[model samples]
Target chain A: MTGNREQLLALRQATVSFQGFVAVDRLDFSVAAGELRCLIGPNGAGKSTTLDLICGKSRITSGEIIFRGEPIHTYREFRMARTGIGRKFQVPSVFRELTVMENLEIGCSREPGVWHNLFRFSGGADTERLERLALLVGLQDELSTQAAHLSHGQTQWLEIALILAQDPALILMDEPTAGMTAHETNMTAELFNRLRGQHTLIVVEHDMGFVRDIAETISVMHQGRLLAQGTADEISEDPGVREAYLGSGGIGHA
Target chain B: MSGKLTRQFLIYGAVCLCILLVPVVVDDAFLLNKYARYLVFGMLAIALSLSWGYAGILNLGQATTFGIGSYCMAMFLKLKTVPVHTGSEGLPDFMVWNNVTELPWIWVPFQSTTFSLLAGILLPALFAALLGWFIFGGRIAGVYAAIITLAVMVVANLIIIDQQSYTGGFNGITDLAEFSFLGIDFDAYSASTYYLVAASLTVTLFLALAVSRSKTGLILQAVRDQEERVRFFGYDVALYKTFVFALSAGIAGLAGMLYTIVMEFASPTFLGVPLSLSIVIWVAVGGRQSLIGAMLGAILVTGVQGALSESEAFLETWTLIMGGLFVLIVLLMPKGLAGAIEALVRRLPQAGNGRSARHTEPDHRPETHPNLGGTQ
Candidate 1:
């Protein structure tokens, strides 16, 4: 099944256990280059844990995480990011004290070292990229405003823009549309659609409508294991997926 | 931005001019030496601000670095001044008074003025780096980092006191020769020594200001606010913390060396918890977040204490008054005097420009400028 297409990321027999309680069991998952894959699951189903493992946020008990065809489970979180993987937390984690422009500037820093950052200034190209990112994230007007002053939805969008500033090859988003309005959600879906062939995205979303709008493929997780994987239509029609969600009260009737 | 720079220069330039004019105005050598000592303390306050205010590492034991620097310089001066033909073995008086012995191996390298000066800065910086490595690398921060640093300071103070023969015990190393470089003598009581200290303070202040305004400074503040986010941004968070910690320690060490030159002694009291905590008080009152503010806080607080101690009426209550002032400042002006002054400055400009006030109001429009990222 994995024969012809190029794989951007692959997790084989990945396992994560916290004090004897297995958060993520031995699992095998693979993502193709430039694919927009949505991960849908009930709470405690290890959806976020899988993303955490892929991003090196959680230590794996045993398994291999191959990124760009190289094993990367041993990589630290920062190294994982430098290796072209970007993860947006479920909560908005933008720097509250900094201006929106500064937050984006930090993301735009190609060499985020102590000395490099110390000497770095918002130069012509950097400032231009930042302004463009602000515009794309709908934060153009609030560039000079403190991120703490941003609305909840705007904060989420700003974080997305921050990730975009890094220009990573692969992006992992956890519940990116959690608190957004319907219109905002639609716009987010459109943004993801526009980013589709340029960036490989694995979006963990409970918003089935959003998943349907943006996901070319869907993976259903249950009890720390993959229950089903296919297109959104196929996954929604799968009896196993319905049983998993119905048993856990995760999703309303399709 | 230029307005802010002009204001900074105006304020700092005035301070520089005032210090430069001190010897010309104040004829009393005693007052000159006293003021120089206060400026040394001010340098310590700036060092604390770098770590605590800017980097968000509340280093509760900053005096540890200061004491180390003082000891380095004192050791060198003691060796230089000691009689070469002492029957007890050409060592400092305290070592001979404790027991008959040769100079310790560690004291040998400090005999050279150049090595001593370099060691004064490097030793404390290295110590800070080691401590920061363990704490920040382990991802320990906030109050826990403070507790660990305080514990380290306490242990260091006890060790210095316990090693009587080597470290001169509670009395500390004293009777130091005057510091001289390139045939230019800096007599402890002379105006030259005062100028030396004043110049050092100015250099350190500017260095701290430059750091506080740099991109690195921005990232340090970011780390203070959101460590995990910076880590996710592909930065080694520990490296930033350790760098600032070492830099602050090196600055404190430099201040310590100046303190020795001004006071003509290095004592265990320099390493004690009381002095460390007092430095924090100065920074907090001045604005731990502002370098110049912290420096002024130290100078002003020390000057006030000196005045109160000399006055018969307030002599008995000076300590109590200082305690009260610290509490009041913490409660009423948590951002410190600098923050208050900044707020006033910002408000004055906004009051003149009504449109600037309107800029702060939320813009509900969903505007897009596609032309912005054309270069990207």
Candidate 2:
């Protein structure tokens, strides 16, 4: 509520349910511009549901999501995405049959309609941006590789690059390092650090070390409700938090 | 991406050569006419590839669009059998035979081939739009969509067969005069029809290529691979599906117009399920995802049909062979005949890198697309 940058969202008493199964109960949360927030929880803790809510991928059962000071309850996923919100799913999301370059091109493409393959795209500026992004994602050497051929870690970075292509104000990434190796986890942590200030990243991760390395502030959720918010060291040692779940081996063994 | 380009071009060039060379050895007019028919089929296959191959739509009623296009041309041909601009009073002869006092309202547009041409293209497009909008907007765009579209073709065939009084019935529209364009006589069997069609094929291919290269092309390709991701990217997925469906319909209609002239007739049979199914095979056999491959597949399969129709050896089993061939392509070569050729090209070590590089960069760049940014 108190920052030089504006609040990107205002969610009041938000709840999400699927087939009468409530995933997120009545919750209140807000995200400010340039905030590096981490949403962490045990399995089925509704961390993903939160990202889905913010990005409009899933409609709220009952709540108000005032995005950028404007309520967008009726907007669909794409319209909300166009409002400068980008989402990267837990699984790497790219056109597998297409080349890496094609995958990136589609990511940056502003086309709102489906096109039949009756036309071909060629240009200089886009090629330049694609190359720049390729480098950013460490894919310069594999631009021609089909996305299907990418390694798990590389696919994660590619998804990140794809979200970046949208030039969004806030990127909602679900499990950015979910299936990565330790080396990949460390590298991604560094990459997130590099992306910290210029871009606002809301990374939903289970890897406490990765989260601890990248997140400026961490928010823990339990049973669809925020349990606590503090720096990594503060939350790890907090007696109330330890007694709540982590003390009983609830999540993140570390 | 470069590999994709080389694969596409090598196959396309080979197809072009084969098409140009076949007229040399085959001296029979009987055989040549069949080849011409196949060429028209090939055009429709290309249209299928444009939609299903590139855009990831399974259009089970392609023949409906083809029928609309062909029937339009047939109506014009039928009208020409009588005097020019003669209205219901003159009657195109069929009307008289049926003891009709007045011509049907739909027949009025056939007074001019241009109107019929536009109607032919627009009708199928409009139909596709309405059907696609309802189905896609409702978020039922898979096997269900194909089934509903197939139902359309069945209804269309039945309607054509039953409406003999106005439509010439099961026999369809036939006994046409020459197809003249701007005073140029284009009578059936004339070299003009072949030339006109051949030229149009080239032009249609070019236009299709341009579309595939356009910005809309990129988004549609994305949709084909990952519809949800495309939806998440601020695209109206239903509208995109509708656009591609309409585009495929229009292109199919264009091929139908040319086909009517080549066959010199249009029957309810033309609207049957086989015509639609055969087009799908053409695309699948040639390369489901490759446009030129789809056209090549159509031409090749239909050309085989022509040869078999005349040959004593494969008379009863030709249909089986064609069906088996499609199965083989789908099973053994998922990428189709084009993949086979691409393998051959890739085998050449010296010809690899440079060819791929040509198709690489253009695929990656994120730029403002033209015409295709309607949704963007």
Q: TM-score of each candidate?
A: 0.94, 0.90
Candidate 1: list runs displaced more than 4 Å.
A1-4, A122-125, A247-254, B84-89, B355-376
Model 1 lDDT per residue over B179-219, tens place: 88888888878788889999998889888777776667777
Worst 10 residues of 2 chain A by lDDT: A111-120
lDDT of each: 0.85, 0.77
Most lDDT-accurate candidate: 1
Alpha carbon deviation, residue B100, candidate 2 (Å): 3.5
Give model 2's TM-score versus the native structure. Answer: 0.90
User: B252-357, model 2: which lDDT tens digit per residue?
Assistant: 8888888888888888887889889888888888887667777888888877877786698998898788778778779998878976766666578536576665
Question: Which residues of candidate 2, in runs, are more than 4 Å off?
Answer: A111-120, A237-240, A243-251, B1-32, B83-88, B97-99, B350-376
Q: Which of the CAPRI classes, incorrect, acceptable, medium or high, describes model 1?
A: acceptable
Task: For all candidates in order, state the fraction of native interface contacts they contain.
Answer: 0.52, 0.56
